[model samples]
Target: MTVTVRDFRPADAEAWVRVRRAALPYMVTTPGQVLYDLARAHPGRRYRLLVAEEDGEVTGTAQVGLSHDSPVPGQGFCNVYTDPERLGRGAGSLLVARAEEYLAEAGARSVYTWVPDEPADRAFAVKRGYEPRRPAHFLHLDLANGTLPPLRDAPPEVELRSAADFADDPRPLFEADAEATADEPSDTPAELADYDDWLATTWHRPGFDRALTSVVLVDGEVAAFSAATTDGLTRYGTAMTGTRRAFRGRGLAKLAKNDSLHRARAAGYTDAYTGNDAGNDPMLAVNTWFGYTVCATEVRHVRTLV
Candidate 1:
């Protein structure tokens, strides 16, 4: 029962995705998406995908990289996931050990990871010299059975549109994402100043459903939007929901999320998922109003390499 850690290969895509989907059902993943990430990652990120093999079979995977987009330097991240059935076989540990070594060599001063809130997961992280920080919750909504808020009449100055409507020009959505992401609470603050990189990564992601993403327009300008990502099956996720600084407190974000959820339900997506930082009271309140309940939680853990 020896576990070996090695760099990820193209052939490992399916197993990598399977391990991720099983261990973290809340996050959307696809084989193509996995490979795309490894290939198109920003050069500054120094991204690497590691896999753990047990008796020649893939048992675990880890994504390790620097938070290159963060304004602060030397911020790194490593998230490891293993087949649940293969836990305690040292797969998780081996993958994490190799990831930390890589991060350290890449000039990462501190490494951040998201560990499941479960006792065993938290204990494992603590044993590895990581300290717990803020917690984030993953919420799920039963779109098929749960009743969504009725779509309210759009105000005279407000108009509803889909992300696809701007396919010809998605710069507005990128601008909104940049603004909103800067406000999110995280150990590494991202400076999304590279629109081309965003287009290659976020906008072109496999599960991004442009037609189902709802956007709010105030006087013909982008005000708020609820970006949607789906697995083309039952799972739907709110990729991002935010309102511009000048448009905050006007219920525009609520309007956009409500519209997006309704559209997701109508499009036959049954389960809706979204994550919120514990400190983001306003967005949490909005999701609660939409009947979403917390299904799982993960705590941010950090270890200083310097």
Candidate 2:
């Protein structure tokens, strides 16, 4: 069985999406979103999608790119996934090799990848010279069966609204997202300086459910928000849940997330997922309040391209 790696083609959308969803069930993805990402990637990102085929069947996929948006330079990322049933057939290793080569050529000094905390996945990264770093947790909530916290009364000056209400001008939503993202704990820090790029890659993404995204307004200003992403079916994810700097410790983030989850369950989504840095106690506490349990853990692994 010969496994070959090559650049992803438009026709490989379905198979690629299948492989990714199978390997990483915690994230939301679709064929159209996959294609859009490939076509709309930032020029500075140097992004590339690769696929591994064995005997004419695609079994593995990889997303390789530089951390162009990060304030820190020389950082890159390469995430690889293989069909669970096709593991150990050399497809994963082949995809990783190709991804590293591409990233190295694109002037990346360090390549970071996420490896499941499971034994085999960790072994694979270790064998490839990658070292373990900070860990992240993927939490799951059975929206269909799990009981969500009742919506508490908002502060007298606070009002709950949907992201859709700001369709005419989402700059305020973007500002809230930027502030919250800047405070997120991660190995790579993001600087959301461009409104146009955010509009193209985030606001317009296929799975983003603006109607379900809950926002808290304090006296007519954005205070906290929980962004929602879905597959237009049974799957739902919390793309981002954050409170602006001034709103910290006010419990507005929790209110927004709770409202979003209730809305999602009402919309018939069965599975809900979210990820958080292990060290983020505040968000972790919020999720726990909603009965979210740790479904899986993944550690960030990095290797220098030198």
Candidate 3:
């Protein structure tokens, strides 16, 4: 049977989740998430979810898009993942080829993707003209069984709150997030300059558990935060965790994450997952202290398009 690649349809949500989970279990996602992301994607992102099928079965999935938020224009991305059981059917190659063609048509000068940190995966990217850039890791913690650090009281000037508290005005959280993201290590940096876009693509994203998200306030301002999403069953995920520039060395990030993790466990979630750049020592140390161990690693790769 031959493999074919096409734009993802609303009905293909389940199969997309199935293949993504099989290929990258550490990145927790669901059918609803896939649909919400596809439907609500920011217009500037030019996001397209592609699915590869073979003989009526989904063999792989790819997220192809132009990074319009990127500070550098003409940048694109295509992250491809194939089901482990569907290898050697050319699903990955087909997806990448199609993705590249779309990106070029969309005015992209370079494309980026994350390749699993393995010899074969590296070889695959090299064969496709991708050059390794940086490394990142997916981490896991047994939220239901692992012992989380005992909750500690914050200083009188510092207080803990949930993202729900900012329901009327999430701009503060957005400000802190933007500042933190500005300094975050990445192959292609993005500036969260548009508040409306953030509200659509991130703050309002499905499964974003505001009640489980912990925010640290210092002097009545958002100093740090730990945003979260859950499958509403057993898997919990850290969407992002960061502290403001002035609060970097104050251990506020740990305070934010610990509070969120405790809330998640109490909410009946058993598995917690997060990711960090290999060079992000401070964040990695925070995760390590919280019992998160490296579950998987992927290297960022980039290829210039002629």
Each candidate's root-mean-square deviation in Å? Answer: 1.0, 0.9, 0.8
After superposing candidate 3 on the true structure, give the runs of residues whose Cα lies further than 4 Å from its correct spot: none
lDDT of each: 0.93, 0.93, 0.94
lDDT of 3 by residue, 209-298 (tens): 999999999999899999999988899999899999888899999999999999899889999999999999989999999999999999
Q: Candidate 1 regions off by >4 Å?
A: none
Assess every candidate by TM-score. Answer: 0.98, 0.98, 0.99
Candidate 2: worst-modelled 10 consecutive residues by lDDT: 98-107
How would you order the candidates by lDDT, starting with the best? 3, 2, 1
**Residue-by-residue lDDT tens digits, candidate 2, 27-76:** 88999899999998999999899999999999999999988889999899
lDDT of 2 at 65: 95
Write model 1 residue lDDT over 95-166, tens digit each, in one string. Answer: 888999999999999999999999999999999999999999999998999999898999999999999999
Query: How many residue pairs clash in model 2?
Result: 0
Reference-based TM-score, model 2: 0.98
> Model 2, which residues run further than 4 Å from truth?
none
